[model samples]
Target chain A: MSEPTADLLVVEDDADVRASLERGLRLSGFAVRSAQDGPGALRAVHERVPDAVVLDLGLPGMDGVAVVSALRAMDHDVPVCVLSARDTVDDRVVGLEAGADDYVVKPFALAELVARLRALLRRGARAAPATTPELGEVLAVGPLRVDLARRTVHVGERAVDLTKREYELLVVLARNADVVLTRERLLELVWGYDFATDTNVVDVFVGYVRRKLEADGTPRLVHTVRGVGFVLREGG
Target chain B: MRRSPSDSTGAVPLSACSPARSMSLRLRVAVASALSATVVVVLAGVLASVLLAREQTERLDRSLVPGSPAVLGSFASTRADLAVTLRGPTGTVRRVSGPELPLSPVGIPTSVTVDGVDYRIRTAPGPTPGSLVTVGATEDDTRARVAERQRLVAGVGVAAVALAAGLGWLLAGRAVRPMRRLTEQAATLDDTTSAVRADGSRESEELADALSAMLARLHAEQERSTASLHAARDFAAAARHELRTPLTAMRTDLEVLRAHPDLPERDAVLDDVLRAQGRVEATLTALGQLAAGDLPDAGGGEPVGVADLLRLAAEDARRAHPELAVVVEEPGADVPESVRAALEGLRMALANAVVNAVRHGRAGSVVLGAHRGADGGVVLTVDDDGAGLPAGEREAVLGRFVRGSTAGGPGSGLGLALVAQQAARHGGGVRLEEAPGGGLRVSLALGPDRAG
Candidate 1:
C-alpha cells in the first residue's frame, strides 16, 4: 500500500495462521517474511536481521521462550513481540523473562500488532540513533556502570552485552538512581507510550535489565517498592 | 437326626434355650418340685401309719387282764389272727385261743410269725398269782392300709410335676418375646431405612439404641458419598458446556474464512479465529489443572518458604504485566514448614490470582504477601488497585465458569475456581474482600499442618 517503514519476521508453526499473519502484515505496510519453526526463524534472522520479529510461543520443534533466549544470547538488539495462545500470568512471565520486548495474545488484531511493532521500532530509534548524538557518556550506579555513548554495560569487572531496549531501560534507571519510578513513568520515558492499554512492556524491559545487570552475581541494585514502583539504590 | 424336642421352636431366642440338651428348663424345674412334694408326702404317711399301729397295739395290751387267762383268751378271740398265751412260775407256755405262742419272761410287744402268719404279740403278767399272760395281733391289715395310702401320694406327685412343667414353659415363652422381635428386625436391616423401637427389658432397649446409632452413621456416610458423586458429574457437565462455547465460535470463524477466500477483511476473521482458539486452549488447560488439584495426595508435599513464594509470585506478576507494579511484603516471621499442597499446584494457584487482577481488574499495581493468620494458619494474599468486585458477586465469581461483573472480555473463568480448589485440597479456604487501596484482596488460608 505504501513504502514499508521496516521489515518483520513472522515465526509460527500453524500454516494458516502464518500465511494469514504474513499477508495481513504486508497489507498493513510492513515487509513481511515467514518461518515455520524455531530453527527456520533463527536461520532467517542470521541471513539478514529483520527490523522486528513476531514469534509464536508454541512451535513444533524449539519452544518460543527458547528462541527468545537464543536471540538475546546472540546479542541481537532487534525487538521481539511474542504471540502466545496461553493467557496465564506464568506463561506470559516466562516469555518476558526470556527477553521478549512485548507480547500479544493469539488472535490479536493485526492493526494492534502492527501498532506495537511500529512503537518498538520508533523507541529503538529514539533510544539510540545511527548518528550517535553527543551526551553524557557514562552512567554509574554503585558497582553497575552504563556506557551510553558506546551502548555497553558492565557490573564491576565483567562486561555485559544488552539488547537495545534493555540498554534504554537501564539508562533510565541509572539516571534516576535513588528515585523510585513507577511503571507508567518508565513507559513514558523509555517507550514513549502515553495512553495506557493494559500492556506490561515497562515491567518486561525492567526484568531484562535486572537479569543482565545481575548476571555477574553483583548485589541487586534495583529494588521494588511494594505497590509503588522500582528503585535503584546501593544496598537494597 | 437326633434333634432335641425343643428344636420345634427353631427361631426361639438364645435366652430361651436351656444349657442341658437332655431337658428343657421347664421340665427340670417341674421334676425338681415334684420330687420334693413326693418326699414330704411319703414321710408324713409313714409317720401316721407307724403311730396308728403303735396305738392299736397298746390298746390290745390294755384289753388283756392279768387277773385271769379268760380275759386274755377273750381278747385274742376278738381278732382272728390274735393269740393269747399263759405262763406259770415254772416257765411253761400254754395257748388259750388262736395259736400256740412262745412263753418268755419279758413282756414287750414284738413282731413274730407263727404257723406262717405275721403277728404283733404283747405279753403281760396275768391277775392269777404266779401266772403270766401274753397276747398277739396280726400286722397284715396295717401294712395293707399303708400301701394303699402310699400309692395315692405317688399319683398326686406325678400330677403336680406335670402342672409345674406346663406353667414354666408358658412363662419362659412370654419372657423371650422381645428378644425374638429384635432378632427379626436386625435381620432385615438395610442402608436406606433404620427403625428400631426397643420395648422390653432395660438391657434389650439399650442394645436396640446402640444398633440405631450405628445405622445412622452408616446412612450419613452413604449420603456423603452420593453427594460427592453428584458433584463430580455436575462439574463434568459444566466443563463440557464451557468448552462448547469457544468451540462454536471457532467453528463459525473457520467457516467464514473458508467461505470468503479472498475477502478484504481476512485479517479480522483470522484474528477472531485465533482469539477463539486461545479461549479453547485456556479452558482446556484450566480443566486439566483442576483435575490435578482434585486428586488426593498420598502425603502433603515438601514445605515451601513463605518468603520465597511471595517473591516468586511478585516477580511473575511484574513480568507478566509490566504495567502493573507488583511488590512483595517482607514476612514478619519465617515459616519453617512448606505449604501443604504440591509446590507446582500452589504456585499455579497464586500466579492465577495475580493474572486475574491485571487482566480482569486492570490493576495498575499489586501487593503479594504471606503471614500467620489469627487462627495460626499460613495466609497468602494478593491485593490489587483496580475496580474490585461487588460484595455480593465476590463469592459467585469463585465458581467455575463464573466471570466477574467487571470482566473486560472473554476469560476461562477457572482461575479463581482453581484457587478455591487448591485451598480446599490443602484443608484451607479462600476469601475475597475489598482492599484498603480500593480493589480486591484475595486471601488463601491454609492450616499449619499443610506445611508438612
Candidate 2:
C-alpha cells in the first residue's frame, strides 16, 4: 500500500521497545523518527511535523496523552496513532478523546499496528466519504437533528454534546434510520473494523450517544432490539 | 496432684455420706419454731402453777380471818375442800381441818405437809385479843385443782407450739419457692435460652436479670468475632480470585516460550511474556494497597491540609506525565481547616485520581482543586478534559475488580477501588461527575476531625 515512503514519528519510554518498533517500521518501508520522552516527542513534532505520529501513552515525563493534547493545541493536523502499554478502555478513549486518530495496545502484533497506522494516514489524506455525509447536509428524525457539515447534533432546542466515537456511532445509526443494525454491522460501519469480535466498544459508544441525546428527558430515539442490535426511530 | 481413693473413683459412697440432711428453708423454719414453742410452754406452765397455789393459799387465809362471813360459812358448812383452825395467843400451833395443817401463829401464808398430804396454810391474829387464827386448804383438792389447771395450760401450750411450728414450715416453703425455681432454671441454662423469667421473688428476678445480661454480652462477643473471621476469609478468597487471571496468563506465556526458544516472533512473544508479568505485578501491588485500605485507623491521626494534598497530587501527576498540562486551581473558600486522615493514605487517593485523569481520561489538562463538600468534609477533585465514564458506570467503577466498559489499557482494576477504600477509612467517600471540558472529574471527600 506504500508507493512513497511515509514519514512517521515514534514516541516511547522503553528503549528496547522503541528500538524494535523503529527498526521494524523502517524495514517495513517507511521513514521513522524516534523520541524517548514527552518533551523530545513535542520537540520532534515542532521541528518538522511528520505525516503520522506513533505515541506511547506512558512516558518518563509528559505522557502520550499530554503529547497529543500539545500537538492538537499547536494546530498540527497530522494523523496520530497512540501506542499504550495499558490495554484498557479508558486509556484508549482518553487518547482518542484528546484528538488522537487511533490507538494500538502494547504487545500487539507489529503488522497490525502497521496496518492501523496506514489506515489512519490514509484517512487523514482523504476524507471518509462513507462516514461523513454530504457537506451542509442535515438529517432529521422527529426532534433529533444531525448537521453533517458542522458535526453537531440537536434535539428540539437543545444541542447535545457527544464524544468523537459517540458522534460516529450516532451518525452511523442515523444514516441507516429505522433499520435494526446488528452489533457486528455497527462495528464495521462506525469503527471501520470488520473483525471487532468480542468487543463491546460499539455498545459502549451507543450508550454514550443515547445518554447525551436523552439527557433532557426527551423521548427515546435509540431503541435497543434485544438479542439483535439497535435502531433509531421516532416511536415504537 | 495424687489421686486418692475417693478422687480415683470421682464419687463418694452413699452410705459413707451424711444422711439426707433436711437443711431446706422449710425444715429450718419448722425447727426454730419448735424450739421457741417449747421454751414458751415451760415458762407458761411454771407461771400458772405459782398463780394457782397463791390463790388457794389466799382463800384459806380469808377463812382464818375469824370474823369473815365467807370463812365462817366455810367452817360451819364443813366444806371438804377447805379447812380452818384457831390457836391461843402464846406459843400456839394450829392444825387446819384440811388434812391437819401444821402452822405457827404468824401473819403469813405457807405450804406444808400434813398427814402425808400437801397443804397450803396461813396464820394471823384473830379478832379476840392475843388470839391466833389459822386457815388451811386441803392438800388433795387444792393440789388437784392446781395440777388440773397446769395440765390444761400445758395441753394448750403444746397444741399452740405444734400449730406455730406447722405454720412456720408451710410459710417458709412458700417463701423459698422462687429460689427453688431459679436454681432449676439455672441448671438448665444453654445457648438457645433467650432470657430467664424468674417468677418467684424480687431477689430471684434480680439474679435472673444479671444472668441474662451476661448471656447477651457473651452472645454479642461471639457474633462480633465470627463476623470478623468471615470478613478475613472473604478477603483471602477475593484476593485469590483476582490474582488467578494474570497468573494463568503468565504461566501460559512462559510455557510457550520454554517450548519454542527459537520462535520466529520471539520479540513479540517476549513482549507478551513481559506484559503478563506486568499484570501480575500490578495486581500484587493493588492487593497490597487494598489490604492497607482495609486496616482500621489507630486513631490519634494528625490533621492534613486538603489544599496541600491536592497541590501535591497535581505536581506528582505533572512529573509522571510531563507532557500533560496539570494545574492546581485556587483553593476554594470555606474549605475545612484540616481533614483528619492518614497522610499517606490521603496522598495515595489523590494520586490515584490524578492518574485516572491523565492515563484513563487522556486528559489534555488536569486541574486539581479543593472545596467544602455538602457533608462538611474537604472535597478534592481532579478534573480532566478526557472522555468521562458513562454515568451508569460511575458507581460501579469504584468497586474492586470492576473495570468500566469505557476503560482501555492494562489495569490492575484496583485503582479506583483503593481510592474508595481510603475514603471509607477516613469516614468519607468518592464521587464521579462530568468535568467542564467533557471529561471526568473524580472527587475525593475526606471527613473532618470527629472532635470538631
Can you give the DockQ of every candidate in the order shown? 0.01, 0.02
Looking only at chain B, model 2 earns a TM-score of: 0.65
Report the C-alpha lDDT of model 1 over B1-452, residue by residue, as the tens digit: 44465655666434345555575444555566556656765676677667765666566556443445776566657768667777777767654787777654456667788888877676777666676777666777766765666567556656665665566557655655665677777766766657676676676688888888888888888889999999988787667656655554455456556645887887887787788788779889999999888899678776777777787777777787888888888866654344655667778888889888887888898889787877777888999998898898899989997877577556778999999988888778999999878999999888767753
TM-score for candidate 1, please give it.
0.42
* Highest-scoring model, DockQ: 2
Tens digits of per-residue lDDT for model 2 on B335-424?
765677787887788777777776677778988888778877777788889978989999988987776756655566688988899888
Off by over 4 Å in 2: A1-236, B1-87, B94-121, B134-235, B253-300, B311-326, B362-365, B410-412, B448-452
Q: Judged by lDDT against the true structure, how good is candidate 1? A: 0.75
Candidate 1 Cα outliers beyond 4 Å, as residue runs:
A1-236, B1-154, B168-233, B247-304, B311-327, B333-345, B362-366, B372-376, B385-388, B408-411, B424-428, B434-439, B447-452
> Among these predicted structures, which one has the highest TM-score?
2
Score candidate 1 by DockQ: 0.01
Candidate 1, residue B452: how far the Cα is off, in Å:
11
Docking category of candidate 2: incorrect
